[model samples]
Each structure stands twice: as C-alpha cells, then as structure tokens.
Target: MEYDIVMEPPTPREFVHLRSAAGMRERSLDAARAGIGDECAAVTIRADGDLVGMGRIVGDGATVFQIVDIAVAPDHQGRGLGSRIMNELVSWLEANVPPSAFINLIASEPAFYEEFDFETCAPELVGMDLTLPTESESSHAQ
Candidate 1:
C-alpha cells in the first residue's frame, strides 16, 4: 500500500479540515481559524494533494511552546508520517526556540513520543486532566 506522500507546510484552512477528519476534538471553526494565526506553524503530509497527516507547534512563540494537533488519517497511520511531522516540528524548535524556553505536549501515545525524546512529566511534578469540564459536560449531555 505504497502511496506518494508529500510533506508541505499547512495553511490554517487545511489544518482545520484535516484535524477534524482525523477525529480530533471538535473545535469551533472560528477557533480553528484563529488558532493557526501567527502563533503556530504546521506541516502536513499529502498524497496527490489530499491531506494524510499533520502536526503543529502552538504557543507564545517565545517562552512557552507546546506541540499540538499531531494527527494522521487512519489510512495513513502505520507509515512514518507522524515521525516526519515531529522531526520537522522539532527541527523548527531547535533552530528557533531559545535554550531557556519550555517545550511540551500532551501526547496521544506516550511510547511514540518517547522515541522523539519527549518524556512524561513526573507524577509528583505535574498534574493531569484526562478530560476537560466542557468535554465531560458534552459527554454527559449526550
């Protein structure tokens, strides 16, 4: 199942659509629209111009930077698109972020991120929320 995967930088519009299709938590289109504005840059993988994978770096672009929205379409999963996206993001961080800056992500898969040098925060040092109140409310209402 080899396909021609091309990695290209993502525009905000394309990022929203691909993120939605990848089963990401639903966000308002306006929020998604505003999200990629200036603060973040994304890389997307496409096959014949159809999006297959994407990842983005989002934050203040200085002191606090978090990697967010890394996703690959189901059909494209098992290939190296996620790694490719991470590599690009990390490279960007290396070239751009200062040594004193903090980079973080709430990974979908801990093991996968570990390969890229991301480690889990120590339980004693950090608190985590598995689901936000809004997400919980939405689930309960449904």
Candidate 2:
C-alpha cells in the first residue's frame, strides 16, 4: 500500500489536473499556460507517473513573491504530502529569494501555513481579488 513519490517540475497539463484533483478552484487554461512553466519555484509530487500534489511560487524574483496553488490529491491527503510540498517550496524560497522580498500565500487553512511562519494579516490588511468575468459568463449571469 506504499507508493514512491518523486518531486519535480510540473507540466502545464499536470498542473491543471493536480489542482482539480486536489479540490482547488479551476483556473483558466490561459493562466496555467502563462504561469506554471515559468514559476520562480515549482514542485510536483508524482506517484507512478501521475501528479498527486503540487505547489509553486510566482512573482518578480527580487522584490515580491507569492506561494500559490498548494494542493494534494484527496486520495492522498492525510499523509502530510501537502507539508512535503510546502517544504520543497519554502526551502527553494529560503535559498533563493532576496531578504527584502515579500513572501505571501493565501492559505485555505491559515493554521497550515502558519506552521511555516506565515502570519495572518488581519485587521490592518486583508487579501483581496478581482476576477473579471469573461464576456459570455458575465452576460449569462445578468
């Protein structure tokens, strides 16, 4: 009942699949194409040639960076695979990101991220997002 999982860079398609299987929000194909391949840091956990977990860091290498899309397949959850993914990601950031760089991540479970020293930015500041609806989707909603 044991499988060997190896960590490596993820392909765009694998990134999309991992995100979905992990129950994360579905991202646009265009965004995945543009981001995953060139992420400042990326890690893919592959079990038997299938992607089972992933995480990435993106943004300008010098001044700002965000850790995004940390996911582990539902079938593989509860095994600390997500933590392993974070370890790979944080290790890379620690070794490479500039001391002045602002590292951030929007954690579904703030407690999970807090284990890695990510503090909750509450009261004083909050994370916000503006998702511009697509032409068809917006029209349909009205």
User: In candidate 1, what are the lDDT values of residues 21-138, reduced to their tens digit?
Assistant: 8888866667666766555566777787677887778788789898888988887888888888888888889989999998999877889999989888877457365755675688
Q: For model 2, give the 10-residue run with minimal summed lDDT.
A: 1-10
Which residues of candidate 1, in runs, are more than 4 Å off?
Answer: 1-13, 127-142
Best by lDDT: 2
For model 2, the local distance difference test gives 0.82
TM-score of each: 0.79, 0.89
Residue clash pairs of candidate 1? none
lDDT of 2 at 62: 90
Candidate 2 off by > 4 Å: 1-7
Q: How many backbone clashes does candidate 1 have?
A: 0
